[model samples]
Target: MSHYKSNLRDLEFNLFEVFGADRAFGQAPFDGIDAETARDVLAEVNRLAREDLAASYTEADRNPPRFDPVTNTADLPEAFKKSYAAFMASEFWRLDLPESLGGTLAPRALWWAIAEQILGSNAPVWMYSSGPSFAHVVQVEGTEEQKRWARLF
Candidate 1:
């Protein structure tokens, strides 16, 4: 039974004490949101990641996915599939996305707080799901449609 350690205390400190993100989230896009909501979100993410998500890691590794040359697709072990199915069932990816994109309007700093847990656990998994973070960058640099695609595509 392996466990991953996340620097949640540091994240909280940065959010509330250091960077004062709590205050920032209280205005504009985060006007209605508060530090308590951020803490609740973090706690939930931590519990899910530690309980449900971590349960899949060892099983998936012991039985890694295999690529099918004929089908041009990979076939993961049944165990891995089942485990990942449960993982996706958690809807971890949809945590802080835009409501239009089926996500809640959580502050970016809060998202970072959640990310630290997932990243600390399986860095590659975190790396693979960089769409939201990258989309933020692209939206800043890209045209209006491109920004729209950040949510659409």
Candidate 2:
């Protein structure tokens, strides 16, 4: 069994009921995703978090990443790498990115809702897989040349 436990019900309540994220979907920049799609995304991510991602939590904690002074790099545990790869394969990280970057223009509320699950499941996985979001920042704030470079990330 996995060590991480998520309250998906409470998350949905906050996102749909209190925050009204459903109202934001299917509108304006978020037209690509509707309420039903958003819910599906949440459900899928929840399963991934509880099953695949959470599978590595205890193993990773027991065998943390190793830093090599000579190589100037840190080598993550194999289990952690597997979990991170699973998340990247899901491609949900693209939700908040711009259309030009092959991402859906999702609402911040929905993004945070998704983030909560990933972070809660395995924070290291979320941290290591932040390249897409960083690329998004560079795409938005960087110069034209920099924007081109950000696409490679």
Which lDDT tens digits does candidate 1 get at residues 15-85? 89988888866577766567787787787777766765566667666766678899899765564455445
How big is the positional error of residue 71 in model 2, measured in Å on the Cα after superposition?
3.5
The numbered model that scores best in lDDT is 2
Q: What is the Cα-based TM-score of model 1?
A: 0.71
Q: Show the colliding residue pairs in model 1.
A: none
State TM-scores per candidate: 0.71, 0.94
Clashes of each: 0, 0
Predict model 2's lDDT versus the native.
Answer: 0.90
Error of 1 at 47 (Å): 0.9
For model 2, name the residue pairs that clash.
none
- Residue-by-residue lDDT tens digits, candidate 2, 75-130: 88888988999999999999968888888888898889899999999998999889
Predictions in order: lDDT: 0.67, 0.90
Model 1 lDDT, full chain set: 0.67
lDDT of 1 at 138: 60
| Model 1 ranges with Cα > 4 A deviation | 77-87, 127-153
Off by over 4 Å in 2: none
